[model samples]
Target: MKKSKWSAYLAVIMASAISCFWAFWGSMENFHEGWHYPTLKENLTVMAIQYLSFMLIFILFSVIAILLPKIGSILYFLIGVAFSYWIFSTRSAITLSVVLSWLPLTLPLLLIALLFWFGEFKNRKLALFIAIGFPLLICCTISIKMGVRVSRRFHDGNYEERIVKGNNDVTLVWASQGPGWPKESIDWAEAQRRCIYLKENGKELADTPQNIWRLPNIKEVTSSLTRNGQNCQGVWNPEAREANYSFPPDKESPLWDIYSPIIYFWTSEEKDKDNAYIVVYHGGVFSKPKKMRGSVGFRAVKSVKNR
Candidate 1:
């Protein structure tokens, strides 16, 4: 009711909200990467633990802060200092932008610590409820919304092959699950080499280098982008190095494994000797270093043999 009490409640709310946002973000990322599809091979329990670690840690901090303000103040202060040090040390050059970015993450912790130390709250029970319940409610609401969306995703379980007819009559058969369609992230060169070595069946690799299958060019990949089993009508502009699509493609069946973390596919189009073009699930095109890996993969394609 008093001004000081209102400030204390606000501090608790702010801290809880920030922690909850990050926890929810992390959880959503994990869900998309690990739990969206039933065929995902990752252990559900392990993924839950790994993704929800942030939420658990923050919840613990919230409990301690609500019950013991003095100790909580010290804990938050130390965390703020450590975070500040980390921000400064990791950057090679300190600029206004860097300082501005640092403030949002570090300043709140420091302020909350000060507020908790000085402010008085007679209703600790209500404070505890606000601190814990608010975040839990937020996380649950958004997660349910996302879960519904993910459940509605379409997967015909036909990863073996798909006939994608592109502009200029560029028709090709996308490879099935094997060397032609790798599940893990791979560098551009390795992807190219793998494609070159892929067998005609598109599911096996040969000992000697072969050209049965190869990486799809940027134009072919862009035009083949699809959404809900429908082509997205994607067009690539090499001069501008950009792509336009009638509808945004999603991580779904046929072209992509919804559960896989690989979002970008390496294209045979090269920007230069050092960099090559890659296409995203949404049909966006960008150039990345040939040697770079992580979240990047390749799906070998070949000319339709019978056609």
Candidate 2:
């Protein structure tokens, strides 16, 4: 093969690899979150659309470049410029780190555009194959991996309230659906208020604020982390700001809805008046602004009755 053909192949590989990475990431995210939808058909449909949307643009560009090089070159350049503008507009300061962070995405795009414009490849078939085949292979590999992981996950199909006993003589009845385990992200204050207003059964809210349920403390969350229906023996150290576990916990049943996108749960521990601590599924704790609510939720718990 000539040098120009090799360069064209490299450009095709780069574009396909970049698109495949985004496709894989989007697929995993959709798999994690899309299962919560009502029906199986809905879940599959939504997941396919969500992940495929990420790759469609790149696939179109590749096809157009193979058919009409000049048009594809213009499209790729426009996309690169759009990405650069978005990145710079979103950041308050145009630091080297910012530029460097975006270079991986924008630079390849610009370079690939130039390559498509000037490079000559007699074997258009090979160029098309590299463009489409590589992404297909990546998507298939990721699908198989995600399928295995999902199949192995522990799910009892039970979402009822349960009493969990943990280290430090901590025992609490975790709330079921509703305020205890909400699907939507919530601010710290709203989480607290919802927990306070949660009724005894944990399925509904009361007219007046009730004390039946409240946000679990960081230690309580850590200590109660479980895997395969067994305690993980998690311990939280406030001084060190760390959590240790005999067996690392996961986003599993009883405590967490594995299909839900909410991975971090708000705890009662406040870093300061402005920030509050949240616990992750794997027994990691971090502080966030009290008002930040993207992927963080709350699970209400009440002290177990003396027995």
Candidate 3:
């Protein structure tokens, strides 16, 4: 009704228009690799979900606040949890609702909810951006956050490479792409390539020069394997696969019982010809000997920063 309310609504309209175009353009660009893939079904699915979530919470709250404003806030809060849970059900969509990511997302919704009751006029534009942009951006921003070299899609479908940095320098590091040999012994060439990759791409202020080396000695390798947190344990799906953040066909989805989450990262340094240092953390901490690579997974690391 008020001028500000109209402005807010206008912003939502614009953001929706822009985001729709953005998603469309993106889908078209990938039409080749996904030539036979579903056309707009998935796109419509995500967009519909996003829009309904925003409208049900913010727009409905505005309508209900005509009488009971506080009750509307409670409803608004529930919308977020519902939205987040829907995301978590699919591992590919988990990033949207995970605790580390959910904080930033929920804050704006909370503010929008409060504003519905507190602001003199409606500003649907802010709500629109929050609704449309938040989900879309969540898929982009984290990949190149801060100053870390956070991507490594080595050997095509072979693996997904990454390095995330922190203020204190090295945080958590591992690789999840290598020969997963269960019946056979681990491959040595793959081990050497992993180390070489790091040496070629390491730095200090910008990348971890020294921190990126392969565990040259067994003592160093074992020490590295047995560390603080345990994300390096468990069996790994050995097929050469790339990291995917979007929906895909049934055959393409990695949700199969056989598909292994990149849980273990092996050091190139070999203790003996048949054995090398491998971080077998699928759950919490890296443990003892894990000779077989079939039931395990591998990824090489390269530190160009303290990341």
Which candidate tops lDDT? Answer: 2
Residues 156-227, model 2: lDDT tens digits:
777788787887788989888776678789999999888888888899989898887888898899998888
lDDT of 2: 0.81
| Model 1 pairs whose backbones collide | none
lDDT of 3 by residue, 147-229 (tens): 12211111123233344232213433434333221112344455454344443333212223333545322222222331122
Instruction: For candidate 3, report its TM-score.
Output: 0.27
Error of 2 at 176 (Å): 2.6
- Index of the highest-TM-score prediction: 2
Q: What is the full ranking by lDDT, best candidate first? A: 2, 1, 3
Stretches of candidate 2 exceeding 4 Å from the true structure: 1-3, 92-101, 259-261
lDDT of 2 at 293: 78
Steric clashes per prediction: 0, 0, 35
Tens digit per residue, CA lDDT, model 1, 98-141? 99988998999899887777767879888888778877776677
* Cα RMSDs, all models: 3.3, 3.1, 17.2
Q: Which stretches of candidate 1 lie over 4 Å from their true place?
A: 1-3, 36-47, 93-97, 166-168, 272-274, 305-307
- Judged by lDDT relative to the true structure, which candidate is superior, 2 or 3? 2
Taken over the whole model, the C-alpha lDDT of each candidate is: 0.79, 0.81, 0.37
